[model samples]
Target: MILVTLLSFFISLSYETIIFCSFSITITIFSLSFISKYPSTYLVDYTCCKPPNTLRSPSHSFLKHSRLNLSSNLESVDFQMKVLARSGLGEETYLPPAICELPPTPSYEASRKEAELVIFSSLDSLFNKTGLNPLDVDILVVNCSVFSPAPSLTSMILRKYNMRENVKSFNLSGMGCSAGLISVNLAHDLLKTHANSNAIIVTTEIITLFYYTGKDRSMLLPNCLFRMGGASVFLSNKKSFRKQSKYLLLHVVRTHIGSCDEAYNCIHEREDSEGKIGISLSKKLTSIAGQALTANIHAFALQILPTTELLFFLKTLIVKKVFKQKNTKPYIPDFKRAFEHFCLHAGGRGVINEMQKELGLSWEDMEPSRMTLHRFGNTSSSSLWYELSYLEAKGRMKKGDRVWQIALGSGFKCNSAVWKCNMDIKTSSDGPWFDCIDRYPIHVS
Candidate 1:
């Protein structure tokens, strides 16, 4: 009987050990799950560089500069002046120093100087705003479509700032205006893969190389539209930034129609009759850009639209595609239902007008874009940030507000990034639009 009692006690001890082991194993798995999960990305802040007022090129000054470049060709001069008057750019827009000079000095040294002027100025402001250490940045992306010289823009930033030895750097050239959001999309994916990190995207177009002396009316449009500006944006997946960050990145949608023959050929860089290199815009650009916008927004709507809108969209699709209903109009979703604000790329007045008509947005919805283009001509890839800055300067951004940023460029590409405001945001005193924000919503007619 004593031996039997001892044997039963040993069995009870073995059962308690088994239960303890099972509980410990379960706790280990729960902790590991948190470690393996992807961290959310945030836009801590951004800075847009406004060159000194001395560089300001009002309409008369811009016209005078153009005449010299077209000095020998009277007809071309007449054509450009007409384009400029209707270009929707206001009197206060700026031009780079090199382009403003007579016998314009668009040399290798001049281009680098332009890069240093814009890039460093923007980075200086960005670092001061966020108090982020330069050495802490783990990833860097810089883009300049026209000017990519030796010791690339990325290397210049690295050497100047002394980034970490293992910093992942990417330099994008020839990607055109859409490259800004493209870089955003790229940085977003990288943040997901590399946990607890910081990234910076610097986007701008070098105006020095953009001027075309040859008389291609197509190429001359670029000369009239583009101006000098750059933007530096900060993004991070660091958990500590969650409380202070301005925007939480929600979604990014990119559409490239470059595979189609007409879309691919609509915009190209080539030499004119005088062997002068420039980017030419096709007359078909307006319609082709419309096509790209439609394709991009359709995909974006599917992900962000509410269930009711989604159902309605699918019903329209079935009626149009499956039933072959010839008379049914294509259903356009009410984007305002999903977003509180819009930062459409201010490509030009024409491009902004096209977006307004296509998206069924009101004039108030189009203010930020129109004002950005007027105040600062097409800054290429960096244009979207200036528009965002306009909204903040006006104190329009509030906690929980959602902003949809749409960017289009020469690759026949349209890319969109959706950002949800993490906190109520007001522009600091240093933004490009800070002084002029109250004066905007100007009569662009």
Candidate 2:
């Protein structure tokens, strides 16, 4: 009986060995077939065989260390990335009691005081919400459309934060509201090179400094439209740091239209003899924006989505073509399929209304933009984030969700950025915007 049992065990072992050998041969053959079908590129680090965070074959300790060093090196590459920070500097220096009242006769000092208040007030709103420490920021970029402060806004931020001497900085003025996204586009490029770097961007329009208190309704629009606003956004390319970040940079599209006088006339600032500064909105703005959006959309379509999806979109366009439909609106690309949240620019009642009419978005979908206009009164470039904050405040943002922000400004430009949410948005009851979020969808005059 013992001899019979041993023979059976040996037979079973032989069968198992044969099966293992066959499986190994099949895998080797399949691997060869795959390698032959694909071209090799040195640019790819072929070692990342699995999706992010998936367990894989162990690497040699030395190889792991080398990869870490390489990633660290990438972070130092000289590139531009827009960041939002150092608003506190502007807040501390400006505002009530310091310069209690406006001067009866206009003076540059009054403008300076108002500008200072604008910068600081906007900064205070941003930093208080973000809870970011001043010293931790590695780069600074600032944009003030009309006023360029002495010592440069960028330098002031560096001094206020006591940032490292080696930290990079940039200040942009007269670029208009679209300048904010341009700054962001630059920042994204910088981060692609410097993986560990963090950049801060502060965006505000001190229209009070350029206030047009003239009799012309065109000049008076600034007083009714422009209000105080500032926003700070932190950007990092380090894979480890992005796990909880609000949005991932997708694509940025810019178009320069109507150059020379005709172009500049679309959205330009001019002052009367009394030194009352104001922004003029031409009747042609809507048309210029339409053309620019068409161009921008085509450019954006080429980058983020797959060729098949693009083909499908084109086919839909062909099938649903409209020749002279009255009250025609821009095609609202299936953003539901593309993004989970929408932070459309809160330029004004007309701007918001036009976008909603064009995109066919419901009032619920436009909660953020509408609420911002009501509370903040069109904060210009920084208005987008305030809208985003509203969504976060309402506890509506979820992980793996997406956000789309579209801004319209000078040059008749319409710029947008897409963000993919990395985690559930957490709201603090302490926010200034918290109580008011519940009362949105209000009528705007």
Candidate 3:
């Protein structure tokens, strides 16, 4: 009787073990299936503007014109010109003819003309390269920080391309330079809801209308840094395009510190004591940007960093927080291990230098950004794309490589976008950097 009872107990244990194994297998299959069906977005192609010949104005010429046009004191004009010379922007950077003329007053008509030229040229080239009709685009996103007309930039694109009547359109204004990636994040969310959709994002800033001609030294910074540029990017979630796409959208992380008064006012548009309206970049902008970037990178690393990196970061956090180790510096993750290419925003030379030091990036990692700034100046939201194009031009981009694009904007916003290369990209003739790429990776100081 004892032997029979022991045998029955062993059989019951064997039956329970088989059931647990079957359940585990079922869950594993379901998880795999869910991952396989997860939605993905692709960047099929992109184009950055090579500003028209009529718009090109060398730095010395621009400074001389500004000195003559502004009624400010001679000392102020000379100081501003000196700032421009040391701003690390090369002579090739283009500006709208209206701004280069340094009109006593900003011209709305000239600003509109600049927009039409930049937007039309960029969109035309993008459509021609993608071979995808504009009408086929289901969503349109246009971002211009300082320029938002009554008809809206998105509406202008619609009319120019004669897109579908039911197409969804969005215009992001006053979001500052980081709005480009903001638009991309918005499009990614929209694509998830609507399958088999195509979205085009146009990023540009109109420096002509926003040109500050006043004597305010802070206001004059934009004049020195901004130049004519625009970029058009095509994104699609259609599985069919995956094979031909250039990059796969991996993640977009954004952090805005506008709630802090100092941050909100770090870069602001206001009328000065003379009632001259202009964007005033605060003296504390670099510090505010660094803080914003710290917050953004911390949040972003949580999502994409490797397990070992995260573990080390957590250990450091524990030592600082739990052990009350006040002297410990926060661990900076080695982003180089994760990203093969870096597109730090070409906001200015100072901005790039601060970022390089903070992130511990080598000069080679910053080459595209420095070159883009030297070649194109600060193109606002479009600068990131120009940097990416530089990497493609040099044949540095390869399949499976990961690219990181980071931008800081006036809202005291820091934003990051990560992309995995989908295929080997060849330098295309339509790219803004294609012709002069061989000359780039040049010394810029």
lDDT for 200 (candidate 3): 96
Candidate 2 local accuracy as lDDT?
0.57
Q: Please provide, for model 1 over 62-81, each residue's C-alpha lDDT reduced to its tens digit, 9 standing for 90 to 100.
A: 77877788888878888877
User: What is candidate 3's lDDT per residue for 237-339, written digit by digit as tens?
Assistant: 9989989999999889999999999999989999999898899998888888889898897788766766455555655666676558889988887888778
The numbered model that scores best in lDDT is: 1
Model 3 alpha-carbon drift over 4 Å, by segment: 1-38, 102-105
Arrange candidates, best lDDT first: 1, 3, 2
Better of 1 and 2 by TM-score: 1
Model 2 regions more than 4 Å off: 1-107, 110-133, 260-263, 273-276, 304-309, 316-332
Give the range where candidate 3 is weakest over 10 consecutive residues by summed lDDT. Answer: 6-15
lDDT of 3 at 346: 93
**Residue 71 CA error for candidate 2 (Å)?**
65
lDDT of each: 0.86, 0.57, 0.85
Root-mean-square deviation of every model: 13.0, 21.2, 8.7
Candidate 1: stretches off by over 4 Å: 1-37
TM-score each candidate: 0.90, 0.69, 0.91
